[model samples]
Target: MRGKSAKYILKVDDDMWLNFDVLLRILKTGAIRFSLGGKCNYGQYPFRDPKNKYYVSYSDYPMSIYPPFCSGTAYVADSDVIKQILTISPNIPFFRLEDIYIALCLRKLRYEITNIPGFHSTKIYPLACLYKSPMVITSHGVSASELRNIYQASCDKDGSMYVPKNPQQLPERMILEQRWPKGKLARKSFKYEQQLLKHNLF
Candidate 1:
């Protein structure tokens, strides 16, 4: 936001699924200030191998481990800290990883990031979990079609809560990772239906 028009900025990976209502919910609380929060990681070791995607040169980062930082998957930052981070970002050496790099800049600005509980980040939760949980849902490493389905599932207004593109296939398809096989996903829908019957979540 560059301290121009917005008070806070929420950054989330494209593949990750989020409930927009949750974002509004977080903002309406008027509690988030000064600090960034998301799926924060700690004591992460730098990859020494050159073949790895996250490999960092000793010159770039010679330390044994990275400072506590938020995962790039998703995070929320305020305009004040964002502006400060921008001012210092140029000074810090370039690191390929955006999340880690942002955290480094934040570290330079003397801001600490903590993990927020509702940010169901990183690991892909089951459809039932996404249906039942009223948290920040993030399903990383999903394909374009799968991303669309997951997004649709969360946003679906029907009490049935079935995916639009291909309901039968969606429950069977790999929504995010290839964790779910063909027929196993029906169970998720079963629980969702049960919840619909019990709580009548719209």
Candidate 2:
């Protein structure tokens, strides 16, 4: 990463709606330069049900409430933060929950996470709400059609799409039918994020 000249590293999941147009402008405007930015989830409890995919064994995480962590859907950390996390990772035991693990590392490093607007990490906002948001970044659990529609609306300068109606009235895609990649494939594709992190490219 040092040789590559990348400044910020953005980690995102496959099932998300990203407004790159708004993100590009935000990055160029240099709003979240120092802090880790994302839709942060606070005091989340670790799932304990054995049948649940996110289940964490009692031995793995005995705490009732976890430390504040950004939703796994999306988050950004600067190169310095990344390097620091790598340096400290040897001490913290391996954690299966990706976002929580990052938060643990950040906590060890005394790094703060800045909750940026429009991350919508847990749910998708209405199209109008998303389109109008200046800091709009990512929406979790979006279908392919939903992703395409959101991106198209972002480019619609003349307001052909993304009408500003009440959220309930809008044609909102509330469910995602997409199937996520299993264990190994998921780990591999995590490194497959966009190169826009390098040199703040649009």
Candidate 3:
């Protein structure tokens, strides 16, 4: 389809869910050669396990370290890179890793892969709120219904719209922090302590 002259092309897997708002925001920044939705692999090795879904046989790829590639869940590529891939693909040996295959083509063309935050490839459940940010691009392992739910939640303007980066801080803590003013928090804590003492619970 890229040959038809599309300026940009976004490719995603069936299980991968995308936040179009965030994607548009990134593209507006300009000159993006390649942007993957999830974590970027710098020096990843080939999957050696024959039983693994991503396993690569020695006949396919003999290289010890793969060229830096974007996670296959989702990625956006500029037309130039697409053309480059189409031009060089026949010359390169076929590999099962589609993402790496594209990456190898880019490497040969001397193009760098760009990174956009919030494009997750992990199986971890996604937080509904983070979609408001331009950084959050893709989430893997989401069902069709859940994708709609996430899109609706992304439109929410309440303080409940943040995605927690640290697992240690629970949602309750976040709510408390956002819901109360600094002075009010201190006073509220003090009053709670007083009530505890009055009840002889302290």
Off by over 4 Å in 1: 1-3, 120-123, 126-132, 154-177, 181-202
In the range 1-202, model 2's lDDT, one tens digit per residue, is 3455977788888977676666666666666676677888787899989999999998999889988888888887677788888899999999998899998988888878877776767554434333444534686766666565555443345333433333333222321112333466545544322211221111
**Model 3, runs deviating above 4 Å:** 1-5, 31-38, 157-202
Q: Superpose all Cα atoms of candidate 2 onto the true structure and report the RMSD in Å to 1 decimal.
A: 11.6
lDDT tens digits, residue span 1-202, model 1: 3447888888988766665656666666755678887778899999999999888889989999998888788888777888788888879988888988897888887887757755655444345334334543454555566555555543444324432333233343434344534365656567544543443222
Cα lDDT of all candidates, in order?
0.64, 0.65, 0.64
Best by TM-score: 3
Q: How high is each candidate's TM-score?
A: 0.70, 0.69, 0.71
Clashes of each: 0, 0, 2
Candidate 3 TM-score versus the reference: 0.71
Candidate 2: segments with Cα more than 4 A from true spot: 1-3, 123-135, 152-155, 158-161, 165-202
Q: Which 10 successive residues of model 1 have the least lDDT summed? A: 159-168
Per-residue alpha-carbon lDDT of model 3 for 1-202, expressed as tens digits? 3457776888888876677766776677774744333357798988899999889887888889998888888888787678778999898877667899888887888888876665667533344554444545676776776566666652354323343344224333322232222465546556533432332210
